[model samples]
Target: MRRSERSMRPRRAGPVGRGDRGYVTAEAAVVIPTLVALAGLLVWGLMAAAAQIRCVDAARAGARAAARSESGADVVRVTRAAAPEGAEVRVTRGGGLVRVRVTVARPRFPVTLTAEAAALDEATVGGGGR
Candidate 1:
């Protein structure tokens, strides 16, 4: 080959390293599952928060019913209707105050949420007539 011809030809790039091959694929393999796990955690967190809000709502509903002098069965029924599925409700009255507590268990996570509400009982608001 002539010297001028060889000089005019393009120089070849350096050989690629073994480690560099499929680097992007390896990175993606790790990153994709991590991203999916993060998304799942976010969804679980949202669900847990929603369950907590439902517990709060249920407690409030039960407290209101108890304060209004509703029967015990009615108070429980209203609270359960307002609560999230598989929740527990408890109502108690003491010192003119009606307290309602609601608890819910998370489906995927090993977590529980509890909420309490209190209201003045109507019967205790006024003294019996003389």
Candidate 2:
């Protein structure tokens, strides 16, 4: 056999197909960033969800306060205080209902959260122990 041909021959039982050698490293190199990005997205989504829930809770609190005839300014302040940082709260009364709307800015990301709640009037619901 010529030297070139012999050298080109596949060696028997060599390291050619030994359990996908170098595959793990290559796959890790390709998939690690994607996984990291997914993790980041998951964290951001969780944060956004939490912000929304908090906004809803704040709205509920404000609506309840406003329904009690509390000062509108105080209700708004309370709502803003209850919400997460960088949040804007708006309270309005119309048609015997107190509506609270909140908008929150996400940290380290470009996102805004909005939530609204209406206060349940005691008069409308059999009165508040009046």
Candidate 3:
């Protein structure tokens, strides 16, 4: 057997397979960033969902307070306490009903969420008697 021919032949006892170089490194290079980005998106989605729930709760809270004939300032404080930071609260009353709206923007994102709730004015409901 010639030296050149023997060098080209597959070695039965070798640890490195023939033509199998850099495969692990290449795969990691492509998969690492993709996994990281997917994880980031999942976290962002959870945050958005939480913020949405807060908006709904805040609106409901404000509506209940208004329905009880609480002062406007007190209602605002109750709604803001249940709402996310930097939220805007709007209350409207007419036709024996009180409506409350809560709006907020997600942190570090360009998304906005809003929720509204309504309740009958306590004074108008069954003549406000137990």
Q: Choose the strongest candidate by TM-score.
A: 1
TM-score of each: 0.82, 0.74, 0.80
Q: How big is the positional error of residue 1 in model 3, measured in Å on the Cα after superposition?
A: 17
What TM-score does candidate 2 reach? 0.74
Residue-by-residue lDDT tens digits, candidate 3, 1-130: 9999999999777575646788889999999999999999999899878988998999999999999999999999999999988999999999999999998865635688889999999988886568
> lDDT tens string, model 2, 1-111?
889999999887857679788998999998999999999999988977887898899988888888887887899898988898878888877776889898876563477
Model 1, span 41-70: residue lDDT tens: 999889888888988999999999999999
Models sorted by lDDT, best on top: 3, 1, 2
All candidates: CA RMSD (Å): 5.2, 4.8, 4.4
Q: How many clashing pairs per prediction, in order?
A: 0, 0, 0
Candidate lDDT (C-alpha), each: 0.90, 0.83, 0.91
